[model samples]
Target chain A: MRGVVLHAAGDVRVEERDDPRIELPTDAIIWVAAACVCGSDLWPYRGINEVTDPTPMGHEYVGVVEEVGADVRTVAPGDFVVGSFMASDGTCEICQAGYQSRCAHVEPVGRSGTQAEHARIPWADGTLVVTPGMPDADLIPSLLAASDVLGTGWFAAVAAQAGPGKTVAVVGDGAVGLLGILAARELGAERIIAMSRHEPRQALAREFGATDVVVERGDEGVERIKELTGGYGAHGVIEAVGTQEAMQQAIRSTRPGGHVGFVGVSHDVSLTGQELFYATVSLLGGPAPVRHYLPDLIDRIWSRKINPGKVFDLTLPLSDAAEGYAAMDERRAIKTLLTV
Target chain B: MRGVVLHAAGDVRVEERDDPRIELPTDAIIWVAAACVCGSDLWPYRGINEVTDPTPMGHEYVGVVEEVGADVRTVAPGDFVVGSFMASDGTCEICQAGYQSRCAHVEPVGRSGTQAEHARIPWADGTLVVTPGMPDADLIPSLLAASDVLGTGWFAAVAAQAGPGKTVAVVGDGAVGLLGILAARELGAERIIAMSRHEPRQALAREFGATDVVVERGDEGVERIKELTGGYGAHGVIEAVGTQEAMQQAIRSTRPGGHVGFVGVSHDVSLTGQELFYATVSLLGGPAPVRHYLPDLIDRIWSRKINPGKVFDLTLPLSDAAEGYAAMDERRAIKTLLTV
Candidate 1:
C-alpha cells in the first residue's frame, strides 16, 4: 500500500508501505476511497511540532470496508463508512457522555494512515458510522467531510451555543471556520459574522450564510464585533485558529456569559488565568467528538440539505497528496481531498 | 463616617472618613447593617495583589437605605436591601443575559466602604434588591452573605451545571467553597465531594451537605476524585481557589464533557493552552454576576432556608473595622462581620 509518512520536520513523503491487517479483534480494514491533509498536519510539516521518526499521516477519510474483524457487528465488507478522526470503544463512560475523543480506550486514526490505499481502523463496530449505501460519486466529498471537519465545525457551533436569535462570530478562515459559519446558520443564528481579511475565504463565508464580514485586525476586530452586537459582543464565538491572539479575540469578542467554542489545536499558546477570569466567558473546546455528530451530518449531506464538501476546492490523486498539503499550507486551497 | 483602609500590605487601619453622599442621580446612601471581609480582599491584604494607596476594604454588605438620589426608584430611604458588590445599570444586554457583573455601565463598590457607617451605592435602582421588609436581626449576617459570597457560590454551582444525577466536587475550603457545597446541595447534586485538608473547613463542608470528603493533597486529590467516580471524574467541579494547581485539579477532577465553575480571583496563574485543549472540559468563572442571583438568594435567606452567615465567625463594631480586617488577614477568622 502507498501512504504518506513524515520522515522529519517539513519532510512528508508518499511511499510504498506494508499493507495493514486486522491486529485487534475489533478492527476492520478499509479500502481508502478518500483522505485529506488536515490543518493540524501542518504543525509538524511547518516544523512547529517536533517529529522524531517517520510517522503515518492523515486521519480524515470515507471508505468501503474491505474486511471486518470477527467481532464486528455493525459494519461488514463492502459497506461504505465514515469514522471519526479518533477511534473509541464507544462504550466507555466518556464516549457514553458524547466525548469520544476523550474515551479511555481511544486511538488516533492516523496510527494506520488513512492517507494510504487501505487502512485498519480500531473499534470497528463502534467507531464507524455506515452511510445508507455507497454514496454517489458526486456525494463522496460531502460524506467525506462528515468524517471530521464538518462534524467538528458543527460540534463547535453547538458548543458555542449558536442557535436561533443568537449572534455568532467565527474567528478563523480555514475550512472548519467556513463550515462553522454554515453550521451557525443551519443552527438558526440570527446573525453570523466571519472575521477574515482574506478575500477568497471572505467570499466563501458569505456564500455559507455570513450576514456580515469584518476585515478589521486584532483588538480593533473585537471592537467591530462589539459594534455589530450593539456593544455587548457576539452571543457566541467560534475560534478555529489556535494562536493566542485568536483565542483572546474569541474571548474578547464574546459577551459576558456567552460561550466560545474553540476547536483550534492550541499551538504554543497559554492563557493567563487573570485575564480569562476577568473576561467571564465560558470556554468549551477540544478535539471535537466528531463521532457524536457523524450520523446526523451524514444524513444532512446525503439528503443535499447542506453542502459542506465545498470546503475541498482542490482534489488530487493519492500519489499527489504532497501537492495537496502544499496548497493548503500555503493558503491557496481551503482544503484538499485525495482520491485513492 | 469610619471605614477600614489598607494603608499598605499588612497594614490596616480604622479611620474617620468623609461621609458618603449621593454622587449620582441613581445613587443611594445605605447605612450598613452588616458587612464582612471577603477571601478576595485577602489577596491585596496579604500582598499577593499589589496595594498602593489606602484602599477602602469592604464590598459585601446588607443595609438600610438612608438616602436616595432623585432617580433611585426601586430603593428608597428606610428600605432594607441586599445589593451585589457590583452596581450595574441592569438594562444592558449583558445584564439581561444574567451577567450583570459585565454590565455596560458597571460600577464596582469601592472606597465609600461598606465597612463604614454609610456607603454610597451607584445605580441603586438596579443594583439593590429590596427585601420584603427590614430583615430580622438574626438574618443580617446571612443577608450580607447573600450580597456577595453566597450569590457567588450559587453562581459557580449554577455555571458548573450541578443538578440531580450529577457528582459535584468542590476545590478550595474558603467560605465560598463551603457555600458552594451548600449551593450544590440546593441545586440537587446527588453526590457532593468537598476537597479540604483543614478540619474546621471540612467540618463546615460536611455541615453544608458534602456527601464525601477528600483530604488527599494536590494531584493525589484529583486521583481520589477519579477513583471515587469510577475513573470518569465528577460531572461538575467548583474551583474556589485561583492558583494554577487548584485550577488544574478542578479540570482534572471533572469528566471530559463536564463543567468547571471557577470563582477564585486568579493571581499569577497561567494555563498552557495545549494542556487545556486536551482536558476537553468546559470552564466558566470570574467575578460571579452576583446581582443576578441576589434577589433569589436574599429571599432564601429571608425565609431562613440557608444559613450562609455561619461563614462569618467573628463580629465587631463598625468602629473597630481595623480589627475585623486584621482577624481575617491573620487567618484567625474565616470571615469577619462589621456591625454598624
Candidate 2:
C-alpha cells in the first residue's frame, strides 16, 4: 500500500507501506477512497512542530469498509463511512456529553495515517458513521469533508452560540474557517464577517455566507469587526487560526457576554489572564467533537444542503502526495484532495 | 463626612472627606449604612496593587438613599437599597443581556468610596436595587453581602452553570468563594466540593452546603476533585482566586465539557493556550455582572433564605476603618463589617 510519510521539514513522500489489518475486535479495515492534506499537517511539515522520526501523515478520509472485526457492529464490509480524526468508544460519559474528542478511551486516528490505500479504524462501532447507502462519486468529496473539517466548523459555530440575530465574526480564512461561515449561516446568524486578505478565499467566504469581509489581521482586524458590529463587537466570534494574534483577535472581537469558539490547533499562544477577565467573553475551544456531528453532517451532505467540498481547490493522485503537501504548505491550494 | 483612606500599603486611616451629592442626572447620594473590607481591597493594602495616593477605599455598601437626581426613577430618598460596586445604566444592550457590570456607561462605585458617611452612586436607576422595605438590623449584614460578594458568587455559579445533578467545585475560601458554595447549593447542585485548608473557613463551607471539603491545594487539590468525581472531574468549577495556581487548579478540576467561572480580580496571571485547549473546558470570567444578580440576591437575603453575612467574622466602627483593613490584610478575618 502507498502512504504519505513526513521525513523532515519541507519533506513529504509517498512510499510503499505495510497494509493495515484488523488488530482488535473493535477494528475495521477500510480501503480509503479519498484523503486530504490538513492545515494542522503543516505544523510539523514546516518544522514548527519537531519531526523526530519519519511519521505517517493525514487524518481526513472517506472510505469503504473492506473488512471488520467481530465486535464492530455499526459498520460492515462494502459500506461507505466517515470517521472522526479522533476515535472514541462513543458510549463513555464524556462522549455522551458531546466531547468525544476527549473520550476516556480516545485515540488519534492519524496514528496510523489515513492518507494511504487502506487504513485500520479502531472503535469502529463508535467512531465510524455509515452513509444511508453508497454515496455517488460527486458526493464523495463532501462526505470526505464530513469526516473532519465540516464537522469541526459546525462544532465551532455551535460553541460560538452563533444563532438568530447574532453578528458572527470569523478570524481565519482556511477551509475550516470558510465552512464555519456556512455553519453560522445554517445556524441562522444575522450577519457573518470573514477576515481574509486573499481575494479568492474572501470570495469563497462570501459565497459560504459571509456578509462582510475584513482584509486585516491582529488588532486591526478586531477594530474592523467592532466597527461593523456597532462598536459592541460581534455577538459570536469563530477563531479558526490558532496563533497568539488570532486568539487575541477573536477574544477582543466579541461583545461582553458574547462567545468565542476557537477550533484552531494551538501553537505557542499565551493569554494574559487580566485581559481575558476584563474582556468578559465566554470561551469554548479545543479539538472539536467531530464524531458527535458526523451523522448529521453526512445527512446534510447527502441532501445537497451544503457543499463543503468546494474547499478542495486542488486534487492529486495518491502517488503524488508530496506535491499535495507542497501546494498547501505554500498557500497555492486551499486544500488538496488525494485520490487513494 | 468621614471615609477610609489608604495613605500607602499597610497605612490606612479614617479621615474627613467631602459629603457626596448628586453629580449627574443619573446620580444618587446615599448615606452608607454599612461597608466592608473585601479580599480585593487587600491587594492594594498589601502592595500587590499599588496605592500611589491617599485613595479613598471600599466599594461594597448597603445604604439609605439620601437624594436622587432628576433622572433617577427606580430609587428615591428614604429608600433602603443595596447597590452593585459597579454602576450601570440598565438600559444599555450589554445590561439588557444581563452583563450590567460591563454596561456602556458603567462606573465604579468605589471611585467615590462607599466606606464613608455618604457616597455618590452613578447610574442610580441601574446600579441600586431597592429592597422590598427597610428590614430588621439583623438582616443588614446579609443585604450588604448582596451588594457585592454575594452577587459576585452568584454570577460565578450561574456562569459555571451549577444546577440540578451537576457536581460543582469551588476554589478559594474567601467571602466570595464561601458565598459561591452557597450559590451552588441554591442552584441545586447535587454535590458541592469546597477547596480550602483553613479550619474556620472549612466549617463555614460545610455550613454553606459543601458536600465535600478538600484541604489540598494546587495539583493535589485537582487530584482530589478528580478522585471525588470518579476521575472525570467536576461538572462546574468556580474560581474565586485570581492567582495562576488557583486558576490552573479550577480549570484542571473541571471535566472536559465542564465550565469554569472565575470572578476574582486577576493579578499577574497568564494562561497557556495549548494547556487550555487540551483541557477542553468552557471559561467565563471577569469582575462579574453583579448588578444583574442584585435583585434576586437581595430578595433571597430579605426572605432569610441565605445567611451570606456570616462571612464577615470581624466588625468595627466606621472610625476604626484602619483596623478593619489590617484584619483582612493579615488574614485574621474572612471579612470585616464597618458600621457607619
Candidate 3:
C-alpha cells in the first residue's frame, strides 16, 4: 500500500507501506475511498509542529469497510461508512455524556493513515457511522467532510449557541470556517460574519451563507465585527484558527455573556485570566466532540441538504498525495481530496 | 453624617461627612439602619487595591429611605430597602438578559458610602428591592448579607450551574465562598467541595451543606478535588477570591465542559489563552449580577430558611467603623457589622 508520510518538518512524501490489518478485537480495516488534506495538516507540513520520523498523515476519511474484527457489531464487511478523526469506545462515561472526543478509551486514527489505500479504524462500532445504503458519487466528498471538518464546524456553531436572533462571527476563512458559516445559518443565526482577505475563500464564504465579510486585519478585524453587530460584538463567535491572535480576536469579537465556540488546534495561544474574567464571556470549545454531530451531518449530506465537501478545491489520485499536501500548505487550495 | 473612609492603604478612619441628599432625579437618600464591612472591602484596606485620598469605603447596607427624588417611584421615603452594590436601571437590554451588573445606566454605590449614617442610592426605582415590611432587629444582619455577599455568592452558584447531579467546588473561605456552599446546596448540587484550611470556615461550610472539605494547598488542592470527582474534576467551580492562584485553581479544578463562576473582583490576575483553550472550561462571571438574585435571596433570608448572616463575626457601632476595617485587615474578623 502507498501512503503519505512526513519524514521531517516540511517534508511530505508518498511511500510504500505495509497494508493494515485488524490487530484488535474491536478494530476494523477499511479500504480508503476518499481522504483530504486539512488545515491542521499544515501544522507539521509548515514545520511549526516538529516531526521526528515518517509519521502517518491523515485522519479524515470516507471508506469502505473491507474487514472487521470479532468484536465489531454495528458495522460489517463491505459497509460504506464515515468515521471521526478520534476513535472512541462509544460506551465510556464521557462518550455517554456526548463528549466522544474525551472518551475514556480513545485513540487517534493515525497509525494507518487515511491518506492511504487501506486504513485501520479502532473502536469501529463507536467511531464509524454507516451511511444509508451506498452514497452517490456526488455525495462522496460531502460525506468525506462529515468525517471531520464539517462535523467540527457544526459542533463549534452549536457550542457557540448560534441560533435565531444571534449574530455569529467565523474567525478563520479556511474550510472549517467556511463550513462554520453554513452551520451557523443552518442553526438559525440571523447574521454570519466571515473574516477573510482572500477573494476566493471570501467568495466561498458568501456562497456558504455568510451575511457579511470583514477584510480588516488584527484588532481592526475585531472592530469590524463589532461594527457589524451594532457596536456590542456578536452574540456568538466561532474560532477556527488556533493562533493566539485569532483566539484573542474571537474573544474580543464576542459580547459580554456571549459564547465563543473555538475548534482551532491550539498551539502557543493562551488566555490571560484577568481579561477572560473581566470580559464576562463564556469560553466553551476544544477538540470538538465530532462524533456527537456526525450522524446528523452525514444525514444532511446524504439528503443533499448541505454540500460541505465543496470546500475541496483540488482533487488528486492517492498516488499524488504529496502534491495535495503541498497545494494546501502553500494556500493554493482550500483543501485537496485524494481519491483512493 | 458619619462615614468610614480609607485615608490611605492601611488607614481607615471614622469621620464626619456631608449628609447625602437627592443628587439626581433617580436618586433616593437613605438613613442606614445597618451596614457591614465586606471581605472585598479588605482588598483596598490591605493596600492590594489602591486607596487614594480617603475614599469612602462600603457598598453593602440595609436602611430606611429618608428622601426620594421626583422620579423615584418604586422606593419612597420611609420604605426599608436592600439594594445591590451597584445601582442599575434594570430595564436595559443587559438587565433584561439578567446581567444587571453590566446595565447601561449603572452607578456604583461607592460615593456616599454604605458605612455612613446616610447614603444616596442612584436609580432608586430600579436598584432597590423593598422587603415585605420593616423586619425585627434579629433579621437585620441576614437581610444586609442579602444586599451583597449572599446575593453575589448565589449568582456565582447560578453561573456555575450548580444544580441537580452536579459536583461543585468553592475556592474562597470568605463570607461569599461560605454562602456559595449554601447556595450550591440550595441549588441542589449533589456534592459540594469546600477548599478551605480554616477550622471555623470549614465548619461553617459543612453546616451550609458542603459534602467535602479539601485541606490540601496549591497543586495538591486541585489534586484533591480531582480525586474526589473520579479524576474528571468538579462539574462546577465557584471563584470567590479574585487572585491569579485562586482563578487558576478554580479553572484547574473544573473538568472539561465544566463551568467556573467567578464573583471575586479581579486585581492583577491574568489567564493564558492556551491553557483555557485546551481545558475547554466555560468561564461565566463578573461583578455578579447581584440584583438579579436579590428578590429570591431576600425571600430565602427573610423566611429563616437559611442563615447567611452568620458570616458576620464581629459587631461594632457606626462610630467604630474604623476598628471594624482594622480587625478585618488583620484577619481578626471574617466580616464586621456596624450598627447605627
Candidate 4:
C-alpha cells in the first residue's frame, strides 16, 4: 500500500508501506477513497513541531469498509463511512457528554495513517459513521471534510454559542475557519465576521456565509470587531488559529458574558489570569468532539445543504503527496484533497 | 466620618475621613450599618497587591439609605439595602445579560469606603437592592454577607454549572469558597467536596453542605478529587483563590467537559495555553457579577434559609478596625464583622 510519511521538515513523501489489518476485535480495515493534509500537519512539516523520526501522516479520510474484525457489528465490508480523527470508545462519561475527543480510551486514528491505500480503524462501531447509503462520487469530498474539518468547525460554532441574534466573529482564514462561518450561519447567527487578510480566503469566507470581512490581525482585528458590534464586541467569537496572537484576539473580540470557542491546536500560548478574569467571557476549547458530530455532518453533506468540499481548491494523486503539502504550506491552496 | 485605612502593608488605622455625599445624579449616600473584612483585603494588607496610598478598606456593606440624588429612583432615605461591591448602570447589554459587574458604566462602590459611617454608591437604582424591610439586628451580618461573599460564591457556583447529580468541588476555604459549597447545595449538587486543611474551616465546610473534605493542596488535592469521583474528577469546580496553584488545582480537578468557575481577585497567575487546551474544561471567572444574584441572596438571608454570616467567626466594634484586619491577616479569624 502507498502511504504518506513525513521524514523531516518540509519532507513529505508517498512511499510503499505494509498494509494495515485488524489488530483488535473492535477494528475494521477500510480502503481509503480520499485523504487530505490538515492545518495541524503543517506543525511538524514546517518544523514548528520537531520531527524526531519518519511518522505516518494524515488523519482525515472517507473510505469503504474492506474487512471487519469479529466484534465490529455496525460497519461491514462494502459500507461507506466517515470517521473522526480520534477514535473513541463512545461509552465513557466524557464521550456521552459529547467530548469524544477526550474519551477515556481515545486514540488518534492517524496512528495507521489514513492517507494510504488501506487503513485500520479501532473501536469501529464508535469511531465510524456510515452515510445514509453509498454517497455519490462528487459528494465524496464533502463527506471527507465531515471526517474532521466540518465537524471541528461546527463544534467551534456550538462552543461559541453562535445562534439567532448573535454576532459571531471568526479569527482564522483556514479551511476550518471558513467552514466555521458556514456553521455559524447555519446556527442562525445574526451576523458573521471573518477576519482575513488574503483576498482568496476572504472570498471563500464570504461565499461560505460571512456577512462581513475584516482585513486585519491582532489588536486591530479585535478593534474592528468591536467597532462593528457597537463597541461591545461580538457575542461569540471562533478561534481557529492556535497562536497566542489569535487566541488573544479571539478572547478580546468577544463581549463580556459572551463565549470564545477555540479549536486551534495550541502552540506556546500563555494567558494571563488577570486578563482572562477581567474579560469575563466564557471559554471552552480543545480538540473538538468531532466524533460526536460526524453523523449530523454526514447527513448535511448527503442532503447537499452544505458544500464544505469547496474548501478543497486543489487535488492530487496520492503519489504526488509532497506537492499537495507544498501547495497548502505556501498558501497556494486552501486545502488539497489527494485521491488514493 | 470614621473609616478603616491601610497606611502601609501591615499598618491599618481607624481614622477620621470626610463624610460621603452624592457625586453623581445616580448616586445615593448610605449610613453603613455593618462592614466586614474580606479575603481579598488581605491581598493589599499583606502586600501581595501593592498599597501605594492610605487606601480605604472595605467593599461589603449593609446599610440604611441616607440620601439620594435626583436620578436615584429605586432607593430612598430610610430604606435598608444591600449593595454589590461593583455598581452598574444595569441598563447596558452586559448588565441585561446578568453580568452587571462588567457593565459599560460599572463603578466600584468601595470608592467611598463602605467601612466608613457613610458611603456613596453610584448607580443607586441599579446597585442597591432594598431588603423586604428593615430586619432584626441578628440578620444584619447575613445581609452584609449577601452584599459580597455570598453573592460572589453564588455566582461562582452558577458559573461552574453546579446542579443535580453533578459532583461539585470547591478549591478554597475562605468565606467565598465556603459559601460556594452552600451555593452548590442550594443549586442541587448531589455531592460537594470542600478542599481545606484547617480543621475549623473544614468543620464549617461540612456544615455548609460539603459532603467530603480533602485536606490536600495542589496536585495531591486534585488527585484526591479524582479518586473520589471514580477517577473522572468533579463535574464542577469552584476556584476561589487566584494564585496559579489554586487555579491549576481547580482546572486539574475537573473532568473533561466540566466547568471551572473562578472568582478570586487574580494577582500574578498565568495559565499555559497547551495545558488549558488539553484540560478541556469550560472556564468563566472574574470579579463576580454579584448584583445579578443580590435579590435572591438577600431573600435567602432574610428568610434565614442560609446562614452565610456564620463565616464571620469574630466580631469587632468599628473603632477596632485595626484589630479586625490583624486578626484576619494572622488567620485568627475566618472573617471579622465590624459593627458601625
Give one digit per residue, the lDDT tens place, for model 3 in B152-179.
8998998889999999999998999999
Query: Can you write out model 4's per-residue Cα lDDT over A1-340, one digit (the tens) per residue?
Result: 8999999999998899999988999999999999999999999999999999899999999999999999888998999999999999888999998999998899899988998899999899889998888889999999989888999899999999999999999999999999999999999999999999999999999999999999888888889998999899999999998999999999999999999999999999999999999999999999889999988888788889999999999999999999999999999999999999
Write candidate 2's Cα lDDT for A133-239 as tens digits.
98889898888888888888998999899999999999999999999999999999999999999999999999999999999888888888888977899999999
Q: What C-alpha lDDT, on a 0 to 100 scale, does residue B80 get in candidate 2?
A: 95
Restricting to chain A, the TM-score for each candidate equals 0.98, 0.99, 0.98, 0.99
The deviation in Å at residue B332 for candidate 3 is: 2.9
lDDT of 3 by residue, A61-173 (tens): 98899999999999998899999998999997678878888776879896667888889999999999998988889999999988889988998898889999999999999
Please compute and give the TM-score of the first chain of candidate 1 against the native first chain.
0.98
- The residue ranges of model 4 lying beyond 4 angstroms of the native Cα positions read none
In order of the candidates, what TM-score does chain B achieve?
0.98, 0.99, 0.98, 0.99
Better model by lDDT, 1 or 2?
2
Question: TM-score for all predictions?
Answer: 0.98, 0.99, 0.96, 0.99
- Which candidate ranks first by DockQ, i.e. highest? 1
**C-alpha lDDT of residue B255 in model 3:** 82
lDDT of each: 0.90, 0.93, 0.88, 0.93
Task: List candidate 1 stretches off by more than 4 Å.
Answer: none
Separate DockQ for every predicted complex: 0.89, 0.88, 0.58, 0.88
Residue-level lDDT tens digits of model 4 in B297-321: 8888888999998999999999998
- RMSD, each candidate, Å? 1.2, 0.9, 1.9, 0.9
Candidate 2 per-residue C-alpha lDDT over B1-340 given as tens digits, one digit per residue, 9 for 90 to 100: 9999998999988999989887899999999999999898899999998988899999999989989999989999999999899999999889999999999889999998989999999999999989999879999999999988999999999989999999999999999999999999999999999999999999999999999999999999999999999899999999999999999999999999999999988888899889889999999989888888887887788889999999989999999888888888778999999999
Q: Between 1 and 2, whose TM-score is larger?
A: 2
Q: What's model 1's lDDT at B118?
A: 83
